[model samples]
Target: MPESIGPRDEGDTEPVRLPDGNLEHLDATVRQLLDQSAEQARQLDNLASAPAGSPFAGFPPGPAMPAPAPAPRPILELEGEEFESEVDTLTDWVETFLMDTYGDEVSTAAPWCLQWQEHEDVLAWLHALWLAYHQHKEPDAGLAGMAVWHRDFLTHTMAAVRAPGGSLSACMTDPDRPAHRILPGPQRSARRTGASTPDTGEAPA
Candidate 1:
C-alpha cells in the first residue's frame, strides 16, 4: 500500500472530515487517487518482471467477451462471388443438417434430385428455407422456435419438393442411375395465317 492512501492506526477509524465547500479537499482527494493508481501500476510492473514460478506468475488473464452476432444475410439479392459464397454455405447446411437428418426415402412418390441446385425453383425454395433456419435457430427465437420451423416451414416445403409429380419428380428416382432434367415451362403457339387459295375455297363452299 502507498503511504499516501493506506489505512491509518487502529484508533483512526474515520477519515479526516473536510468541509463540503472547500476546493482544497477536492484537490487532496484527486491527489490521493493519483498516488494510489501510480502505486498499483508500479506493483503490477514488478510482479510482471518477477522470476518464473513466483506466486503471481502465470496468473490467468480476464476472459475475453464473445464477438457480437453477425448481421442477417440478405437472400436472393447477392451476385457473382457473393452469390456463390452464400450458395456454398447453404449447400453445407442442406447436405449436413437437412439431408442427413430429415431426408425421406427417395422413390417415384418422394422424388429427390442430385442436381437440385441447378433447378432454379428448387434453388429458390431451399435458399428461402435456409434463411429461415438461421433465423429460428438463434437464441432470440425462444424455446419453441425450431418446433415452429418444422411445422410451419419444413414439413410443407419437404412435401412440396418431394411430392409425386413435384419439381424433382422426373429426377433421381433411382439411386443406382442418377438423372437431372429441367421441365419446360408452358408456351403459347403462334396463330395460323390463312392462304389466299384457302380463303377462295371457303368462299366457294
Candidate 2:
C-alpha cells in the first residue's frame, strides 16, 4: 500500500557507491559459486569417459577376475609291445652274463644247459637274480665272489628250475633222467669242503 518503487529513468545516470566490506563479501560469494560449478563439470566429464568396470564409478575393479587353473599332465601307460621288448632285452643280458662268467663249467658239468633257453620261467627267475647281483656285487669280493655267486645265485636258480614240477623237470620224458646237476664236483668241493682246490677237475688229496 506504501508508495511503489519504479524503475529509474535512463537519463538518471549518477553512480551509486557501496560500502567496501559489502563489495568484498559479494565478490567472494561469486568466486565460490564459480569454483563449485567448475568442479561439478570436471566430475561429469570423468564419469562420461570412464570404462564399464572402472574403480572411479564406485566399487574397486571386481577382484581381478581369478586366474584360470593349470591343465593336468597326462599319465604314461606302457603298452604290451613295449613290455615284451623290455623282457627280451633283460633275457639277453642275463644269457650274456652266464656265458661270460660260467660258460665253461656250465657246458662241461651241466649238459642240460642247452635246454635252458627253451624254459621261460627259468630264464625269468635267473634274469631277475642276475640283475640283483649285477647291481649289488662288491668291488673287493675276490674269492668270495665265486662263493656268493655259486651259493646264492646259481644254487637258487638251479633249485627253481629243477623242482619236481619245475620248468626243466616238466620237459623230462624219463622219470630217472636228471633234470639238472649241482655245480660241477670240483666247484662244489671248493665252496663247501674248504679245500683250496682249483676248479680244473683236480682232487684235493
Candidate 3:
C-alpha cells in the first residue's frame, strides 16, 4: 500500500520549501479542508443568527419537490476539537515522516499547525472528511478499501488549497463544487419532475 499523504507547505506567508520534498499538494488539500470548515462555521453562524422563519430557516428544497425540507444547519454538530484531532493525526504522521527523513528542520508547520487556533481551512477539511466518511456506506462486494482511499483523496484534495503559484482555491473548489457534475436538461442541481402540480391536474413540462 502506498503511504497515505496529505498537503504540506512552507510556513512563510508566501511559500517555503521543506528540507525534504515539497508537500505543496498536501498543503492545498489541508487548506481546502480549512476553507470548508470555515464555511461550515459560517453556515452554522447563519443558521444560528437567522430569525425563526426566514427563507433559509428550514432546509432548502431538495431534488424531490415533496421531499422533506433541508435543515438550515447540520443536526449532528462537529466541534473544533474533534475536527482538529483527525487533521492533527494526519499531520503527526507527516511530521514524524519529516523528522525521520529530514530531522529537526521538520519543525515547520504542516498546514494544520496553526499560528491561530481557528483557521477556516482546517475546519473545512474536517467537515468534508467527516461528511464523506460518515455519509457514504460501503458499496456492494463489501469493498473495504474505499474508506481509506476516500480519506486520502480528501486529505490531498482539501490540502491543494496552498499550491505555491496556482489558483489553489479554484483547484480545491473543484472537488466540492464540481464544474461539470451538473447534468444537462431539466433542473440544474437535481432531476426535474415531470409530475403534475397540485392545483392543476396537468403535468408540468
Clash counts for all predictions:
0, 0, 27
Candidate 2 regions with alpha-carbon error over 4 angstroms: 1-79, 99-120, 138-147, 163-165, 172-205
RMSD of 2: 24.5
Q: After superposing candidate 3, which stretches have Cα over 4 Å from the reference?
A: 1-109, 114-117, 137-148, 161-205
Against the true structure, what is each candidate's TM-score? 0.58, 0.32, 0.24
Cα lDDT, model 3, residue 48 = 81
Q: Which scores better on lDDT, 1 or 3? A: 1
Poorly placed runs, candidate 1 (over 4 Å): 1-75, 188-205
Q: Which is better, 1 or 2, measured by lDDT?
A: 1
Model 2, C-alpha of 148: deviation from truth (Å): 2.9
Pick the lDDT winner.
Answer: 1
Candidate with better lDDT, 2 vs 3: 2
* Per-residue C-alpha lDDT of model 1 across residues 13-121, encoded as one tens digit per residue: 6567767768787899999999999878877777687787777644434579999987655546678998888889988988999989999878888888888887777
- lDDT (CA) per prediction: 0.79, 0.58, 0.46
